[model samples]
Structure formats: C-alpha cells, structure tokens
Target: MPNHVAVNPRDHKDLRILEERSEGMGDATMCCITFPEEFRNLQNHYTILFQLDQEREAFNCLAMFGLENGENLFLDNGRWDASYVPLAMDIQPFMIGRPSDHDADRKVVIDSDSPRIGKGEGRRIFDDNGIPTAYLESISNKLSHLDGGYRASSEYIDCLKKYDLLEPLSIDVTMKDGAKNRLVGFHVIHEERLNKLSAEGLAELQSKGYLMPSYMALASLSNLSKLIARKEAAAINV
Candidate 1:
C-alpha cells in the first residue's frame, strides 16, 4: 500500500518526484492495466490482452511483460525494452482520486511514501510561485484521459460480451532449455466469431471505434514470437 495525500501548492510547494525509469522505483511489475486507446502503441512491443477482474466484475486491458508470473522480460538491464510505455505505467505515484465528501470532485493525489518522492534532485511539481509545472500538468491530463478511457473500455468489453465475441485462451510453450510454460485464464477476442458477425453488428463496432482495437489485439498475437525470442535470449545469457 502507498501513503497518499492530496496535493496542494500551499503545503507542498516544493514537492519533487524522481523521474528516472529505474528498477525498484516501481516498474518491476510483470503486467499493467491498459486500455483500448493504448492498444496501438502497445501492439508494437507488448501483447495486448483483456483480463477479467472478478472482484470488480469488469474487464481491463492488460499489457503482458512475460510468459509466466513475476518475470518482466521487457526489463533489459534495468531499462524498459519498448520505445512506447503505457500511460498507466507512466502515471507513477500520482493518481487521480475522488473525494468521498464531494461526489464529482477529482483531485491529484501523490504517494508521499514513494521512494520517487523526495525533497531534492527531482522534477518539481510546482514552481516557486506555487503554479503547476508543465510536467505536472501533463500528468494531470494523462490521468484524466485514463479515467475517461476506462469507462469507454468497459462499454467496449460489454459489447464484446453481448455478442459472445470473447473466448478463453490458453497457450502451452516449450522453451529452448526444455522448460514448459502453460499460460491460462486470460480472455481473447474470438476472431472466428468476430468475422462471422452480422453487418449491423460490424457497423456498430466500427462506428464506435471498437473495431480497430480488436484488430490491434489480434495483431499483438504475433508478438508472442517476440516474447519467446526474448525468453530464449534471457535463457542463453543465463
């Protein structure tokens, strides 16, 4: 858990956050919550897939980092291998929070306990005049975009569910060193069913911008080969 507090220029005018993308600074995770808006960039380097969150009873886009659990293959020598990093990953210790007292109030909250947050030698969140810096404004905009993207992503997932276009996926692979990896429990877009949809159904998806994200996800399947090659390279170097 992170210790979060509302960010205010009056009290935290000198807040500085570490901007370096380094391991142990919070990028060690094997997967991250992604969205349809991110599918295009994600397809270039990472496998884009939808995962069901049983607790929330909704689907979220996930960008996979490794074949199995806890192994982040994209972390090469403490550096991320991809040219495009997801916004969810870029948001870092700052997150959008809605106050319970106010129904529609959205505010920026920072994890004061995060190692990234420090007093010296980092990106300043506010200027000496207590105005938000360009970097801070960018983070605020990204978080706001993410908030809206998630709502649309949920509706898109519901559409796929309504048409029964999502199917369970399982993949079994044999690594070069005779290690077996069996990945299961993730849901994938049903390409066969997708192709056989009615004209009206196709039009609905196309009009809503859902069609492109679906194809982007299917295209990401080719990245499995890239994942395997990276795994092989890691194994060889070991």
Candidate 2:
C-alpha cells in the first residue's frame, strides 16, 4: 500500500528525496514498462518485447532482464549494471495519478513508504522561497513526458497490431544446474512478416516512424544470451 497525498509547499517545503539508484529504489524489476519513445536507449541494454495486459487486453512494451519473476540479472553489487536505465525506472517513488471524477486532471504523488523519501544527500524539492528546485522541475517535466508517452504508446501499440507484426514468444533457458526455465506469454515482432510487408504497407509504417523501433526490438533479442551469461556468473558465485 502507498500513502500518497497531494503535494503542497506548506506541508512539504523541506521535502528532500533521496536521489540514488539501487535495487531498493524499486528498480529490481524483471521487466520494466517502456514506450516507443525509449526504444533506441532501451535496445542498447535490454531486449524490448510486448506483453499482453490481460486485464486491459492491451499490448504494452517492456524491457526484459531475466527469465523469471524477481530475477533481474542486470543487478551487479546492488547496483544496476547498465549503460542505460529506462525512464520508467529512473523516475521512481513519484508517480502520476488521475482523478476519478469527470474532471480529468493528473496529480503528482509520492510513495511515502519508499526508502527514497527521507532527508539525506538527495534532491531538494523546494527552495527557501517555496519555489520548485531545478531537480524538482526535471521531475515535473518527466511526469509530463510520461503522460505524452502513454498517449503515443497507445498509438504505437495499435500500429503494431494493425499490421499483425507481433508474434507470441516462449524462451527456454537451460540453467547451470541442468534446470529448465520456460518464459511464456510474451510476444515479439515477427521480422520475417515485417520484411514481407507490401511496399505500400511498408511505406505507411516507415512514414509513421514505426519501422525502426520494430527492428531495434528484433535486434535486442540477442542480448538474452548476455542475460544467460549473467545468470551463469551469478550462479557460479553462489
């Protein structure tokens, strides 16, 4: 559970959030939510794939790390050993909330229970004059980007579905202990099908700037081997 309240300068003028990156910051996720806007950065480190949100029946992109839940092989010495961390992971403890009434407004709320919410060598949310600090402004911008990203991602997901490019995927991992791990219920873009699209169809997608990320996601599949190596290394230490 989260204790989220509306942010106000009067009550939270001295709010100093810990700005550190660690598994404790809720970055120890096997898969982090991502959008098409981050494909280039995300592809460099993790495999990008789409998974079905069974409740909403919508397709969403994800940056995969390990084969099982709570198994993020990207963690090294309690630190995220990656050149790039997804925006979704970078902005933690703070989240955008929507109103339930007819008025559609988003509120900025922080998870009170988060370890990041203590006074320390972190970011100061407000200044002496009660104005937002530079760090706080950046967080505000990120929240706005997230809202836009969700809108753009909805369009991107539709684009992939309209062309039937998404294909179901099941990854089988052979662990060092001779145990088998099967990752199922995920989907990836079918490269063959994408390549086989008609000239007109390809032109439409290329015009929309959707083709590049599709290919990038396909390219990222190779990093799964890197994940396997990571898993192996961790197992050796144990």
Candidate 3:
C-alpha cells in the first residue's frame, strides 16, 4: 500500500525522487491509465484501450506498453523508448488530493514509501530555501494534467457509452517460440459503429470535440504489431 501524505516544505524538504525508468522503480506495468487528451501522442507508440473499473463501474482509458503483466516493452536500457510518456506514469510518487469530496482546492501528495523516494541521490523536491525545485514544478504540472484529465475522461467515456461506440477486444499472440498469449477484458472504440454513425451523431461528437479522439483510439491499434515485435525481440535476447 502507498503511504501518501500532503507535501509540505517543513517535513519533505529533503525529499528526492528517482526519475529513471526500470522495473525496480515500479515501471514494469503492462499498461497505465490514460485520457483522450493524450490519445494523439499515445497513438504514436502505444495501443490505447479501455479497461473496465469494476469497483467504480466505469471504463478507464489505458496506454498499453506490453502484452503481459510485469512486462513493459517500452523500457529499454534504463530509459523509456517513447516520446510521450503518459502523465499517469510520469507523475510517479505524486498525486492530487483534496481535503474533502466537495473541496475545490487540490493539494500535491507524495507516496513516501515509493521506491522512487531516494536518499539524496535523485531530483530534489525542494531547494535549500524551502522552495519547490524545477523537477518538482514539472511534476506538479503533470499531476495537474492527470487530475484534470481523469475527470474529463469520465465525461468522454459517458459520451462514448451514450453513442454505443465501445466494444470488447480480445487479442491472441503467438511468439516465435510458439508460446501463446491472450489479452482479454478490455474494450476498444467500435470502428464499424463509428463509421456508420449518422451525420447528426457525427456533428454532435464533433461539437463535443470527441470525433478526433475516437479516430485516434482506433488508429492506436496499429501499434499493436509493433508491441508484438518488441516482445518477440525480447524473447530472442532472453
């Protein structure tokens, strides 16, 4: 479990966070939450998919990095091989928090127990004068983007649902060694339905600024082949 606390200069002035990408730093996940706003960038390198959040009874967007658990094909030689890392993955050890459900103000919270927490060997969160550092400022921007994106994503999903534009996706992959892998329990934009939508429907989606993201999600499927190639190469090296 994460021990998250509101960040304050008094108690967290010495805090430093490692920014390297590695399995040891909790970057081994196969996917991370993403939003439609990021679809344009994510589609270039990741397969964007929608996953059901059973607890919340809602669907959340995801940027797929690998086919299996604990496998992140984008992590190469201690560096991420993508131009745009999803804000959710980039804002590690930091999150937006509110004092109450109705609170309008948000606070930056840190996961004190995260592996990224460093012993004065990484990016300092604050300077000697108790001011946030440039690294921390960047993180704050990422957190804000993620926080706002999360809320906006819910509305996007609702719009998709209203138009019945989502469908289940099941992918099966065969490795060079004849090993089989199956990706299940995820959804994707229904391209056929989207193509068949009426003009009014299209206009509505366009007016709401969802038309392009819908196409972006569909286009991201092209990266699945790239993902499989990476998996095959990794297997050969191992």
What's the best-to-worst order under TM-score?
A: 3, 1, 2
**Better-scoring candidate (lDDT), 1 or 3:** 3
Clashing pairs in 3: none
As for TM-score, the candidate ahead, 1 or 2, is 1
Against the true structure, what is each candidate's TM-score?
0.93, 0.92, 0.97
Q: Write the per-residue lDDT of candidate 3 for residues 100-138, one digit (tens) a residue.
A: 766567889998999999997899989999999998999
Clash totals, every prediction:
0, 0, 0
Please report the candidate that would top TM-score against the real structure: 3
Residue-level lDDT of model 2, residues 17-63, one tens digit each, is 87565677666668988887788888878988899999988998999
Return the number of clashes found in candidate 2: 0
On the 0 to 100 scale, the lDDT of residue 194 in model 2 is 94
lDDT ranking, high to low:
3, 1, 2
Could you tell me how far off, in angstroms, the CA of residue 78 lies in candidate 2 after the best superposition? 4.2
What is the Cα-based lDDT of residue 209 in candidate 3?
Answer: 88
- As for TM-score, the candidate ahead, 2 or 3, is 3
Which segments of candidate 2 are over 4 A away from where they belong?
101-105
Tens-digit per-residue lDDT, 146-223, candidate 1: 878876788889889989999988999899789999878788899999999999999999998999999999999888
Over 4 Å off, model 1: none
lDDT of each: 0.86, 0.82, 0.92
